[model samples]
Structures are given as structure tokens and as C-alpha cells.
Target: MNQTIHKSQEKNMILERTVSADSPRQDELVPSRYALKVGEIDVMVISDGVLPLPTKMLGHNADSATRAAWFSDMFLPADAFDWALNAVVVRSGGKTILIDAGLGSDPDLHLPRAGQLIKRLESAGIDLASVTDVVLTHMHMDHVGGLLVDGVKDRLRPDLQIHVAAAEVKFWEAPDFTRTDMPQGFPDALRAAATRFTREYRNNLRQFDNEHEVAPGVVVCRTGGHTPGHSVVRLSSGGEALTFAGDAVFTVGFDHPDWHNGFEHDPEEAARVRVRLLRQLAETGEMLVATHMPFPSIGRVGIDGDTFRWVPAFWDY
Candidate 1:
């Protein structure tokens, strides 16, 4: 009896260690990447992990009681929660495009749970050198920091084209945080990350004024809300379409399109942009995915009377 008990304890310890975050990527307990097709374009939504942030960030302008009520209705903690971070890989016209690299590493930020993009990509058989283009919806650290990860630059192709809005690049030069309501130290960290990313990848940036096509059926259009140059990517081929909304819409925006996310540089404009996009998606019936939505973020927007509704797409598998 003693021997059997000891052996069981040892086995449990091994299992725990294997499932820990530091374990090999192959040992991950849950699926980290999801694949789907947008007409003829091949798309994959890879989980970059989650960012646990204060609940106040969800709707900084709302009254505390109202915000708490929303959280309660959603069955989420009223104080804080994890915000999903997702990146997409698109293949069309013989070109591979990456949308919004995940947050790399920021030790001082104490967000060690995120920055899993690179390893997850490798596990999914996506080679950095194979990426022909990168579409950045915005210049936020979480969206561009993955490229700044040590050794990532050396692995990427020298000819890789990074498509971003011209205004986004210019805004980062002297970023305005007066309208943002981020937590302490966020502004400084964001500024530093943007500056570093720009300096390091200046040669690869392909700036567009309003809209640009990075690949066949892959169009990125500037939205100018969350940031001075925030944008979203639209994928259309055959008869299907999907939009990868970066930071423009969040989990809460579906229910409260006007709630101001703390990360928005211009909260009011951000709200307007969210409502406009949701309305358009609802009318057209196009599929939607966003950076901060729950993983596999694929869904369709619906009109819920005066508000909006999120109808998650049924998993193909």
C-alpha cells in the first residue's frame, strides 16, 4: 500500500510539471490555435495568451454600479479579468500575412501570462521566414511587441513588408496620451515600445494613407479611433468575408457599444467607430474577429434593439 501511494504522488507531480506554463509547448493542456477558411483565403487564429487587466478598463466612463452590473451579468469577476490576445495568419494569392503580432515580453509590466505568439506559431508550423507580409491594425505594444522579441527580427525575411497606416506611424513619433485613461506606467511603456518597434523595423514599414492591399483579397483600412491610425483588416474571397478588428471592439462593446475602453486614445471616437462597424457587420452578415474578444473570436454581429449582440459562430469542428 505504501509503495503504491508513493508512486501515485510521483506521477501527480510529473503531470503537474508537464502542464505548467514553463513546460514544452507541445504539452499545453488546451488548444492554442484555431484554423478556418474565409472563402478562398486560409486563416488561422492563434492564441497569444491573455492579459489580465482591471475591470475598469472595460468601460472607464461608466458608473461603477453599472459596470459592476455588466460584469455580474456576464458571470465575470467585478474587479479584474483576462483579456484575450489573438493574432491571425492569412494565406492568399501565394502570400502569407500576419495580423497583429502578440505582446512579446515586458518584464516590468508583470504580465508574464501573455507574449506566447512566437512559440505558438512554431507549434502550428508557421515559420517566421515564410511570412511575406504583416498587417498592423495599430501600433500598440501588444500588437507590435512580438516582432521586437529578441531573435525574432533575425528570423524574419529581410524583404518582409509590414503594412500599417501612415498616420499610425506618424502618431507614434509624438504619441498623444492626453485622452487615454490607461493604468499608471502604461503610457510610458507604450511610448517606449512603439519607439523601439519603429526604430527597429523602419525599413520594412509600408505605410498607406487610408487603405492598402497587402495580399489578394486582404485589405486593411484605417479606422482612426482607438489610436490616431487604428485600422482593421478585411478578408474576402469567394462569397465569404471576415474582418479582423484590432482594438476597435471588445467583449463589452457588443453589449455597450458606447462604453469607452480605457486604452482608447479618443474614447468618444472609438465608441462611434465600434457602433459603425457593428452596425455594418450586422447589416452585411459578415463574420468578425477582434484582438480582445475571447479566443477563436469568430462571430457575427446582430442588432439587439438599441444595443448590439454578439452571436458566436458555431465551431466547424
Candidate 2:
């Protein structure tokens, strides 16, 4: 983690808030749940909620008609895509690590039926008060908004340790929330949110950097490109391992080494990181986890012909 002093100029905060984040409505509860075991670590996936976005959001080159066709095959709305948001919990070494908190704001897309991250924790009999750390994959609203309860004061647990990336913090600390191609009001919301982040809850924040091991069984790897300073987690106990790849690639077919969504800050660099991580994860042959991937997004990655494909876990709960 970066111990350097933070300079939260208005410029950087705008850039940071405009970046990518999980999209889901908070009203929904009873988040979908899935379990994976990595050695002695117990990993649980609590559903955050699901958002149906424009099908065109799939790929930059994909036009309206193309997106419609893709959605048509699935019998979904011609113009929409339903994406799921998940928060994974790993319990090992007596350290409870919760990766990516769910949606807290966004009333329009909020799933009055899906924001049960906390309830799921309760259902699993896991105590949120005991959770030691909150590791964010990225600071988009869906991922970090849960740090505080909506419209409530002093919501975050006092003892919880929050870790983010130095690079990500830098991006949001800049001024001018608007991106080059974003909509008009996008920049404004982003800018406002960044300042709120600094003023409201700066003390609990720690900028995660490099490959630091947060616990005896958990190690962090710098895997930016999805959002600047985006990081992935590696959990190992006994001899089993799991790599939590948060939004590096959304779908199996979309996991091309050379492919990247237009939203990426640097498309070329993002593509390179995609390939590198794919190769590394494949060689390890351990289970994988994804934030935006379908429910119970934990599984395996394999080489298919020339590209990689997600091999979803085979089991029914």
C-alpha cells in the first residue's frame, strides 16, 4: 500500500469518480450466495444485485443491431444486458476479507429486490462486525458506496480496515470529473462524489499497492486496466488457491487477450494485462472468481483454440 501523503486536488477526484464501478440497485436484498473452498479458506459469494444495461455495452465495435441480435439469442430485451454484481468473502488465517461492497446509491438502477449483501452475510452466519478488512477492486459506486449506509450517519464499522490502490486514489483525486467522451452530467456526479469521499471517510482508507500480503493466506496483485489501480486477490491455504479477477474480463467469450472494452483508460495496455493475467491464471489451474460474471462466478479458466474461456463450476446448490 502507498504510504505517501494524498493530495486530493479537485482534478484527480473527477477523473477517479468517472471510472468504472459495479451497477446495481441497493433496495434489493438476499444477494445470491455461492461457496468455494481454497485450502482452509472459505470463500462466499453474496449477490449485490443485477442491472440490465444496453446490450451495446458488451463491446465497442458492437453496434445496436449486433447487440440486439446477441440479446435476441438469449431472449432478453433487444436493447438490454442483465449483469450481476457479487461480493466475495474469504475466511482464512482468522482474517475475514470482504472484496468489493455492493450498491449503496443509484436509485434508478437499484434492484429493490437485490441489495442483500449484508443479509447474505447474516444468512451465512458470518458476523459483519468481525470482518477485518474491506478490500476494494475498484472505487466505482457499486464497489465502494457500501462503505457507508445511505442517508445514515456513521455507518461504517469503526474497526474495519479499508484498502484501495494508490493509482486509483490518484485518478479520483484529479479535478474535472468529466471524461473526454462521457455524457454532460457524468463529470458533475463524479466530481461531487470524489470530494464527498475525502471529506466523509478518509480515515478508514488505505491505498493498497504492489503484491502485499494482507493476511497469511491472502496476497494482492496489481491488476489495473479495468480501472486504474484495479487489484486482484490471491487466496491460498493448505495447498488450494483462488484468484479473484474483478472485471478484468466480464464474460468467457469476451476474455480475449487482445480485446478490451472502449471504457478502458488505455485500451492497448488493458489488452496486454488481460493476456498476462490469463496466462498466469491458466497455468496455475486454480479456481477463478469474477465480480460482474454470472452468479456464483467462481470457476476455472482454460485455453480454447487460441483464446481463453471460463469453465463455470459444475454443481447445484
C-alpha local distance difference test of each model? 0.93, 0.68
Best by TM-score: 1
Q: Where does candidate 2 stray beyond 4 Å?
A: 1-31, 62-77, 107-114, 151-156, 175-191, 252-257
Write model 1 residue lDDT over 196-272, tens digit each, in one string.
Answer: 99999999999999998888899999999999899999999999999999999999998888899999998999999
**Backbone clashes under 3 angstroms, per model:** 0, 23
What is the lDDT for 131 in model 1?
97
